[model samples]
Target: MSKRGNRLRNQGKRGSRRAAAARDGNDNGSGKRGARSGERSRIGRFVRRVIVLGVAVVLLAAIFLAFAVGFAARSIPSYYQLQASAVGQTILVRARDGSEIVELGPSFGEWLDYEEIPDTMVDAMVAVEDRRFRSHFGIDFWRTGGAILEGMTGSRERVGGTSTITQQLARNLFLSSNRTFDRKAREAVLAMALEWRFSKEQILELYLNKVYFGGGAYGIDSASRKFFSHPATDLSVAEAAIIAGLVKAPSRYSPTADVQAAVDRAQVVLRLMREQGYITAREANVDVDTVELKQQSGQNSVRYFTDWALPQLDILLPETSAPIEVWTTLDVGMQRAASAAIESNTPANAQGALVSLDRDGAVLALVGGTDYVETNFNRATAAMRQPGSSWKLFVYLAALEAGYTPDDRVVDTPVTIDGWSPRNSSGRNVGETNLRTAFAYSINTVAAQLGNEVGFGTVASMARRFGVSSPISTFPSMVLGSSEVRLIEMTEAFAAVSAGGMAVEPYGILKVETAAGENLYRHEAARETQLVPDYVAAGITDLLQAAVQTGTGRAANIGRPVAGKTGTTSSNKDGWFVGFSSGITTGVWMGRDDAAAVPGLQGGRAPAQAFAAYMRYAVKDRPVEEFDTDLDLPEWRLEPDDEALFGDPDEYYYIDEDGNLIEPGRRDPMDDSFDVEGERPGGREGNRNGSGEPPPAVSEDFLERATGGPVRAPDPPAVPPRQRPRETLDVPPAPSANRQRDGGSGQDQLIY
Candidate 1:
């Protein structure tokens, strides 16, 4: 203020002198006008200079404040260093069987220290991300100027960036996402502070380990692990470069999420490496397609199974990075077979489940749903649906336990119970038939009647023992297999019988290991004895074998000795087939995601075909022998009928000493001698129980009148028959009926 006052006084004196001079020159009008104009111009120029100085001072203070805030933010701890007390972003670790599956970073992005990363990995990363990184403190001003200059004349994206890894990490970790001048200044300030606080190695390490590489992978370790199923240090040149280039935009360079973009970005990185003299041009320009990533890396399709196995994993292994080896029983062959069987054979509109288990509860192959890629729906253990006639297997077991025999007859007539009248799917009568025929045909009427006779409580108790979670009803409908059951339950129950009647729970995930290869835990199959007499299971098995050979499961017959039963919900809504050849037990289920009906669908059609297809590989090179007929079985024969036991009754006088009509209370007359087939088990020597398809169908249908070539190669057999308890076809299932059914549409097994 004092200086301004002195200047003003001087200016006033000068102006007065000028005024006196102007008065003398009053006669000269031009001179007076010139003096006035000059004084006005000087005053305006002084004010403009004052404004310019004030604006410059304000901008300097703002820049300082921006730098100060960025410096403070740079003090936060990194992802690897953060503790519960640390004021840093969250980092959640996920492990399976004590081995890290993946680690998720906080919204701020993930970070790791230099010591935690491999030097090779760091080198590879630098070579691809920022070849000039070491020469620059945090950012490369010269390169950035070039980038900006190039971008001014070209598209921004096409021009790319020259930010060193450290600067990029600073921008990602401690600054705004904005790109305006103010934001750039803040980013620059943070970059400088990061350089001042951390060594160059430290900065680059954080950049390499914190950046996302898409496919939900965070950090170079995770990105490498996610894309190649290998550790960062193990990365090949191409693989390392591919991950390195992901820093620009993870989604664009993700091998799984965007393969084309990833390849393109990888090429750019290779070119940059050559231009920057990191590698020879010829070395850098290798074909990326020739690179082989770790198998099953980006396609972690086993997520569902891995998730379900986690809870059990905790009890077996409560922590990560242990030294105990846990071997899983998963057979990759079986897993792939199950997946392929479902994907290739299931009707387009339908979703399905496939589970393969050993007699001792070991899960050989398990596919929870049609597409793990589309949805992680674990149909094997999570989904529940009515077992349909498949539930009859348990009913039959209960009947056998209650002293019923294969020859025992049950009525096929409609019956009512608790306001429900259960009828056969076709609503037709097949007259009196033996249990073998009844089960083979999947007769709903007979099954319901038998369920009533066995006592609903007895059937329910048996099913529960076999590992069913849903409640079973005490009604006639229970016989027709109307209770909701999971694929695991059916698989376990059927596996029990195959295992001589012992329950085997399906399980996956052998063990998980740390980055250093330290084993944490392993899985053990849980076995529980669920059946009393092994013979009872074998009896059911004998009948089931016939089903695949000649009954509804004919499609399931791969010209080999296969034992399985087919089940179809009314109207082709659900189809199921559970089969076993000695040790391998596979269960298949097909149903629409929206629960739509498929035309001509039966358990034997697509489900059986799929089972057979998978079985071919699931048991490849394995023994193909069945349980010997003489193993721990009871000495029993087909029971005689009422006509033989009661000497033929003449009226509805209800004579057999029981109130029941179709079922008799008096046991049928026993056959003093065993039936020829049951007595001489060695007769099966002629059966096709070996390792391949039976001699191409010598049946009249498959062969032409002369040439044995299939009379029109059978359409790759669809799964499960078009229906359970299929009607005695007015005509055989041929190509003509097949095309018509596809056009007609329904849950009846149309391929579409």
Candidate 2:
């Protein structure tokens, strides 16, 4: 009883203390603190009170976080709302004559919403990238474990990412690309927030549109257009499977990279469709034997065209606003033609490219090389091949400007500049020849000589004035195309020649029209200076044209008038042909990827053949429009000290070897003068001259004779000149076992 009383007393003391504390609380501003029961009171009451307060706060926070995540998830964007659009890049066509090349690709999307993405496309991606997509909320814990385990093992591979579609959506949308724990934590929070805020369908749509599919493609829409040339809305089963397969590794599965790999990946997706019940096991068509799959060729090989088109995009859309598809002027048929011809004609070990453009510098079709897949080195745009004799045009243009007639003789013998001797490809020097034969036969020696007479600086300036971005230093050998030039520059320079020497900047886009049909931009060429005199350019065109009829460029002739030059560098390391017709101009090149010498890949051979094949198909239905005439030069041909049309052709003396009017061995300048017509060896057109002198030109008295009389000199061609076919040498000198032409990176050139 005493013990019980003590307990009671202590309890009473505790109660008193508690009551005092309650009174203190009342005094401090809480109405009153509840007192504990006097003796043996239960602890449940106090514990319960604390529990209730914690629960209430947690419930409120849950409600608030739920609201926040929902709002944030709903705010996900379909596309980056960049304040401005990036400018497009430029590409040149490799067609022979026409610039408006037809190209086929899916039309641009008007406005693609993620929700409209086909379910198949989504599932295909899940099958290859993350099969557990729908089952996970925002993160795949299993995949995360795998990633960690793999990372710890030292391989540190990126193959597995645990983040679910929700997490990816959050990261891609609201986060940055830094791979750090802080970023991962933020990503997780965003994922959870997104899951709470949006429905799976909504999250899925955002994911589909946000994921990058590689190869410069962004959303599914872009991937669809670039790879298959079709929109996601119209995708077929095979195409959908292919796209889904690409999600694993777009670059790896890109048809452009490996068609077989892409096809195999698609098959894997088809098998997944069977397992997922998206298709019946038998109906899934996973059995290669049963299903006939139409392979979608990636042919993103618009390499050369893309290069040309990319630049015009910025000009048309401007960096300020690129909100539309800049429809290019490429001709699908011609582009296909150019690409196919190059691929088929290029030697197995050699790479090649071709481009065709209109007189206005509008690209028609382009192929960078035989295979952009094996190597991304775009031969058409990025590869600088020694232009060989094709570089003579600049030298010839300079000669024309410096008052050197094409008929004037230039020694075709050996020439040395600063200890660097230039030799003809044929190796056998064809003694004294005229400019026509030198150009037609691609005589390197004469070009070097003329380059010296005209001054190498003059040739370099002429090339630059025409907008050939290629660098050409003032070197004597530059006349032989020792300087490097890209196929596009070569073709564009020729286009300038075709356009009456008017400088024209090439473009891919005509206008950037919005979905709403608002014209954002329209592109018209910005003109540079006229590089050559009309008559001079026209005369050069006429001279090179004969190359097709009876010269080294004849392989390019395909029943129509054509003018072009053949270029084969030392050791045949680079071969090129640049030609133009009435409304179009094209450049072609062939070489080995390693820049090694390839057998029989000269510009006049394979490249010219490819051009012919493309043009044969490209110009079938078009009218036969001849090249433009030179209004600058007088209409009728007159010997204004001209060597071919006048008597004794009041010779505009060229400094021959010994600096004498006539070598002691020859009486007349005719013996050494360049033959205006090359076939006769030191003789008149139909008469034999034993004195080793070409017969005098049309007599001035014959000019005074009759208009109907064929007294002496031949009359100049009448109608606006038609491009004559070009011919190639039957047997070009084989590549030497030693030495290659001086070529550098895409833009640089070094010839020593």
Candidate 3:
């Protein structure tokens, strides 16, 4: 191609080559211009792309901020609920004398306004908890940035020191103390919400009022009272510092647990306050010895009483968020006496419960157990125990209501009802005697016969009428107090008797008042309804008086007129004594919680002694008053008759060395003449005389007639004396001369 120009007619085109050079110059210039234009176009396209990317990034950031705000708003609670959380109120239970028994629910001190809080307290709180609390809206961006930086660089597992005062308040009011990402997000949102709805001062007030202090105290007010025995208005600078320090670790810095540790923590708070200009340097130097602490009273025995009465408030008043003051019917004095008596008299291996009621059915004193601290099970109001022979009160009451008086004649021989044979405690029949005598002697056979005479259903009904709310089956054993019942119910039943047939529902609470002194509940006067006819009650009272005056209940005597019943369960598992005197009724019970038998346990022993001891203090101030025995009924004076009167009228009853009833002409078994046939006596034929016709064989229907039920067959061969079970009558005592006149030697001794 070079040659093309070479040969191009070398010589011939000298003029043509000059023209081509001009054209080439023009084309080259145009090409350079085009290249420059393409470069400028590429630069413009890159600028446009960069502008679009910037716009998209800004939009994404705005969307993220919107989503975060919406999520936080959704987790916020209503304003009313937030305010309600601040009024955590507790109930204060007071005795009849207005002395504090116990406080139920979380310990809460009196409510106070923001202005009521001491300035030093507020300043110390702000200095130690959050120095920049006043400046931040809800979150501290500066602190948050520091926390994030530290978390990334430091060895800490998680970010911390990010929560401001507002944030802490939000957590206390609405959020849990869970260190989770979601929780932190919610807490931040709630803090912002609080800041929006409440002012700075209002937020501070809520925080101070809702925060927890150590030792079961809540709020600054409670802390003040619990630590200093004064109101929040009287908070000293040192005290304020000590309380403020507790917000970090309450139990570790509790003034009650360790005063030195609390004071050391408070020193840190004081230094922080000084650094923040909240206090002067001189003011920050608080003397540790000046921090006088007043701890709450140690756990009290009266806690048992309050625990029992706490549930009753729900029935007595409407639910409320305000504080309550419960005025109970408990007599502080009686309660102490009852506690002492039970503690002194209760066996070491056994527990005791006591209940005392006024004629109006007001519970004056109740001891659920010997030591409430060991166990809090309320035996008086909750334990279900077999009432034992005390149940005979209902059986005899049914009989008396069935037109049978105390003077009604009854036999005290071994009796069987529905295959259940019961013998006198003495293991020997007293033969024939009036109902009064039989009851005073605690004759189990007479009680069984009386229960059969008045249907078991009737006996149960009588018990229910007397205030035994426990379920009572119609089984014949119920007549002997086999049913389980609460001690409160039994005592209430006796209170009804003391009230002259008026039905009684025992009550412990008298009134409930609000912290503002408004009446939330006031017990209305109980309506008096007839549970039993007055005559029947009087007749029952007669039997009870006779029992206490000269019978098994003699141990319960308080040197005054008293009426009561004694009950000893089988195997000595339970012993009970319930009595009334000076218009006050009380019941005492002793037993093991496992129902384990206590050797030598009897109603006439420990139970009776406790009842007497308590009653002595209970009625010490009341005037001595006798029971109204004027029922205008027929006289029941005893007189020697031709049947089996072998001694003086007053000496017809006989008792052996063990204070158990013995048959006439049965002298001391150790005497040589005790078994002499026909020895100066008018004994029945074949009855220890060994001289007349043998006793007739028992008829097939005899057991059925005696038990008020059908008998499958005649009695089996007589059981050997040693093989048959003996129910020795657990009687207290009687005069010894009565037995001496019959045949026993003159020696008074009581079998435990």
Candidate 4:
């Protein structure tokens, strides 16, 4: 307008036209912009309305789902009713006299209330299981969302597990153990219901009562008692942590099944507790070292009997909900005595087991080891060890059954069978000895010869008859106890002999009864078939009696008539003594569990000593009954003929310094001066009196001439030294103190 205004009035009309045209263009542009803004506003309104409708539909769907879940929850069974209908009770095992031996429960054990559980146990459970248990209302939404996200992301370490403690309780109580969305939805609903119905403490109580702690223990009360021998209230922090750790996998982490695994899992729980401020690191460390797990009842010496009887329960009472009482054939007094004897007589580095049975095959006493707390291995009935010379009992029995008399002569010299030569433990061969003497001494050579004569197969058959169930090798060494056998079987074998050759099956359970005094089952004593003839058994018993009286098993004699055999394995790895009285039969074995040899240990030592010590108490207050030796047996003549012995010059006679004759094979007394010198009918050159005539009593004149000293003759021999029957004594030595017979190297000596 400024440029056009200069054009003056003449251009006024043209300037006005140009200004109008510019104004029109501006108006058109403004109108188009306003139309576009209005259209955009309408489109925005439509989009907002669609979004509001979608939100309303989603809210309606959510309301419907919540209502559906609530309605479904009403169909769920009541937790209280479920528990009330559950079947869980304890079965008690009693001794023969009605004393409680042990108690076994259902697959799970008794329940405990929340107040009865220790705070440490609850803290451990919360720390290791669900840290938000106290604050969460059945379900943890934050964890659930995170778990869903992690699951969708395929994260390896973050697998979905959004269940809280209440949820787990719901699942365990009402839901099946199937990993499904439907099950999880129900679990969540039930968990919510449970949380609404019970307080936090009540929920924890229900969870503890329903959880499983392995070894057939369920609930905190039973788990605590089973693992710590105490109530849940008495559990220490370490033990509580151990129990809490078993929730994931009970049997895998059971303290009794795998202590190290339990301990490791407990360590993790302790760490979690420390992290959660439930316990301090120092407290956890101390408890870790001090925790003591309960020894399983099966670890007791009574386990040897109980294990044999537990299976009978299923057969007697197939399905029972009430408590049952099992009466066993166990003598508590004898069990204690046997345990004491084994512990006292066994070496510190060695282990010993003993098993005793009555003539009727009732297990009277059993000691699996010196201390069951140290090891749960039931050596009395579970371990197999070489019986050593004790095996000769069967071999000799086979021979006797084969018509060989106790007095039958057998060569005691070394012999070979199948390129296997057996040597006597004595290290010297008694040229010839009767079967009785050979068995008494446990001569390996004679036993081998007898086994060969009767055939190893026959020997094995005899062993089986006597209850030697372990496999027997058909080798010559088998006669010398080369085969392995258990103490229970060995004791049963002797019990069979005590039962007059009847086959005996060792048993402990006598009867089972309900708490109401209703007899569920009673064992009827069965008549056993005769495995060995009365005469054969009697002959073997005679030989074994001789063994206890005068041979290797002499240490086992308890002043009454006893029959037994001593066995010492090679390198002294195992020592055994199996014996029987008229009423009871007992077996004692000593060895290292690892098969390591114990120096100086022998069957005649600790094993025999243990047998004797145990037998003394086992037969207390019982009548001293004698074995039935009714068989007509040949007489045993052990004394050698003097003429036969003196006929050979090579058979040198043992003589003392005083010129007294001693038994040819008997050992000389340590205090006596003895020598083994070749002696002719006449005295030798070095003899003080060379003349083959008894020297006149020493006189003072003769002593002075011979010694060139004024020494009076030594006081006349207290008792004149007896001269040899066929030889004259040249000089009589000074009299010595009274001497007793010394059964020395030829006799079996106590090893340790």
User: Could you give the candidate ranking by lDDT, starting with the highest?
Assistant: 3, 4, 2, 1
- The order by descending TM-score is 4, 2, 3, 1
Segments in model 3 whose C-alpha atoms lie over 4 Å from true places: 1-87, 108-216, 219-298, 633-752
Candidate lDDT (C-alpha), each:
0.65, 0.67, 0.77, 0.76
> Which scores better on TM-score, 3 or 4?
4
| Residue 348 local lDDT, model 4 | 76
Output the number of the lDDT-best candidate.
Answer: 3
**Residues 261-345, candidate 4, lDDT per residue (tens digit)?**
8888888888888888999879778546467777655345676567656776777676876777888889888888888898899
| Candidate 4 residue spans exceeding 4 A from truth | 1-78, 81-89, 106-123, 130-202, 210-243, 246-264, 273-300, 632-752
Q: Between candidates 1 and 2, name the one with more favorable lDDT.
A: 2
Question: Per-residue CA lDDT of candidate 1, range 40-121, in tens?
Answer: 9999999898889888888898798656856654675654562122122232223322334333233322344567566545
lDDT string, candidate 2, 1-752, tens digits: 69999999999999999999998877766322324333224577677878998999999987886775676656744334421222222222322333433332222232456567777787766765667877776778888888778778976545434667777667666677688999887787688776666677766766676566666565677778777666788766677777777766778988767778888878877887778777676656744333233354545566556655666554455364323445567777777888888888888788888878887877777788676556666777778778888888888887666554555555566656666677666678877666777778887766766666556777888889877787777755677887787888888888888787788666666665554566667666685677677777876777668777678899989787888888888788888788876568888898887789887678788878888888888778777766543435442233322332332334333323344453233456354343556335546343344443454433445434534434443333332221211222222222221111211332221111
What clash count does candidate 2 reach? Answer: 41
Per-prediction TM-score to the true structure, in the order listed: 0.51, 0.59, 0.56, 0.64
Off by over 4 Å in 2: 1-158, 171-189, 199-248, 254-294, 297-311, 318-327, 336-345, 369-378, 473-475, 558-561, 616-752
For candidate 3, list the clashing residue pairs, or say none.
Answer: 425-728, 425-729, 426-729
- lDDT value, residue 549 of candidate 1: 76
